[model samples]
Target: MEQNNMQDLLKRYLEGNCTPEERAQVELWYELLDSKKAAANEAELEEDLAEVRTRLAMPFRKKGKLFRYPAVAAAAAVLLIISIGSYFYFNNKPSGVPQKANKLLATDIAPGRNIAILQLGDGTEIALDDQSNGAIAKSGSNTIYKNAKGQLTYVATESKEDETDNPVSNSLRTPRGGQFQLTLPDGSQVWLNAASQLTYKISKTSRERLVELKGEAYFEVAKDANRPFKVLSKGQVVEVLGTHFNVSSYDDDPSVKTTLAEGAVRIVETGGHRNVVLEPGQQATLDSSNRLSVAQVDVSDAIAWKNGKLNFNQSDIYAVARQLSRWYNVDVVFKGRAANVRLSGEVYRNTNASKVLEILAFYNLNCKIETNNGVKRIVIE
Candidate 1:
């Protein structure tokens, strides 16, 4: 594979002075060189390669000093090698390749649109929409308000005599593509991601800090050794005390993923398993294997959706496609054997999905997008 040996092989093959097997070896090396050069200018490289192939096919001419100009040919050979190298790198690399960048897709769910609702204890409903900044209403002694970012904040009125009321729950609901943050009556903070819901009561009067979650949410539980914070997701229960963690138990997704960012959490399954403890940077999953699996992961990426970005260090095409479908509300299909395609990189949640697909196509992995029955579907080209 040295440069000199490669050049000698090419020269011999072009001169039609090598055996059939030797000629094949030279042709393979030339193809590899062509690919390397193509990374910069694919279209132009294709043209040059075609012309060089024609010249190479013709019988070699004997000029005294012509072979001295191997530099020109060497440059071309390296370019081809790089291009082919890129192809193999992408195709044969391990899963979760970072080359397939993330893109924002068109959705039944659009970005930056606010759609959240609040329900009070006595069954009173507040639209939360069209509510001006600052105080919106009062529930008992607490004043409900909206901040500049449209998050709901509750301020309890000061009174000379303290009296605690029975625990009554209020719920925060976020529609698809919507997210909002709130501090519960108990001073515990909850960040609700798209299409998620959390129900909690005010802190002091409540016996313990408890919240029920559907979909995804990041919790920063207030430390109350006497009153443990419990998060109920589906039939699973996660108990924590003054810790930071993210839970993704969306019914639409196959598994319930609980990633611990700080402190510790005890996850309880429905089938009478005592508890599974998670450490920081650890993820516990209730996968299709009917077993709970735990592993160390990049905690930041596991919770990136809360920050309005899709961060993929090395993700497979299928996983990326599934994320796009959920975020953009699209369906994806594959026409070719794209099983080995891996992608990397990050993208904003607000960009168009088509642009991302086009970039992938540039890498020789083609994709076609179509609209069907008012739904968008993408197929591998």
Candidate 2:
């Protein structure tokens, strides 16, 4: 639609006369707005919106007034309308509706934290969460410690490596609503996301560095000319001399994704029959059928958990829901037909899950959080 018509539609939406389909589409555009750093509090935003309703009707609803001012300006009615209109015009979406947003509860479900368990070669498990920073344990020839800086590191001396002719193996695993960073004996750093695990084995007798992964992890591998770093996840293996990359191998996901951030990586299917090389900003996905496809991607989406953000940019409802389920430790159920909507914008990792649900529900009109049998869930219609 034309920008002028887009502006008129915004006026009608605020007047509460939009059709259901129009309303849903407009709200989807609202979700696309970048409010991650909005200076206004929730209450203030709502109050200003009420005033905006009156002001929108009185003036500036005239034809072609859209985009008369700078965007990302405060949620002033004219500016927001213009911004939304511009988005609609450029993206080829029809004009949509508006509704008073409902307030989100400060629900008990909190965000994920730095928590994980370390299992030694001797079969001993150490709870790393709530443990004070200090020397944590000794595994084979490796002395494991959690430094004051909160990095879990292992120190292996040459003599100790010699003492252990047999390889020493250990695993670091994170549960739902948990995350962690581990520095391997060879100095490669791995950041494990929620519901993920990384297992590594090292030996002086071995020539290569290898680690097995389940779920997702970001790696900053330490370089050694003699030893190439290799990551083995379901269906695929990634080999790099020394580089930064992220691997997501969730069992529930249809594909295992390996994203290269800083260096080159060679990815091979488990059978070693198919292979692909990736450059920075590229990704290789191994599907359930063992077919591999390469493409360029936004690397931030792959490592957003490590960087402390939840991204919804150009994402479907199910994709956004899966991230929330992992970080909030909740199950999502569809009450009727799933919303089948897409979302955009990035939320602070620190924000409560309820706040997100509120925004999502505001646009979709049929999503909310509830507790049944003491288990938290997001019910979608």
Per-model TM-score, in order, reads 0.64, 0.74
* Per-residue lDDT of candidate 2, residues 284-311 (tens digit): 9999899999998878767877888776
Clashes of each: 30, 0
Error of 1 at 270 (Å): 2.8
Q: How many backbone clashes does candidate 1 have?
A: 30
**Model 1 per-residue lDDT at 225:** 91
Candidate 1: misplaced stretches above 4 Å? 1-112, 159-164, 288-290, 313-318, 329-343, 358-381
Q: Write the per-residue lDDT of candidate 1 for residues 153-253, one digit (tens) a residue.
A: 77787872533575667888877656788876557778888678898776465557778999888988879898889998865789998899999888767
Top lDDT model: 2
The CA-based lDDT of model 2 is what? 0.71
lDDT (Cα) of model 1:
0.65
Worst 10 residues of 1 by lDDT: 95-104
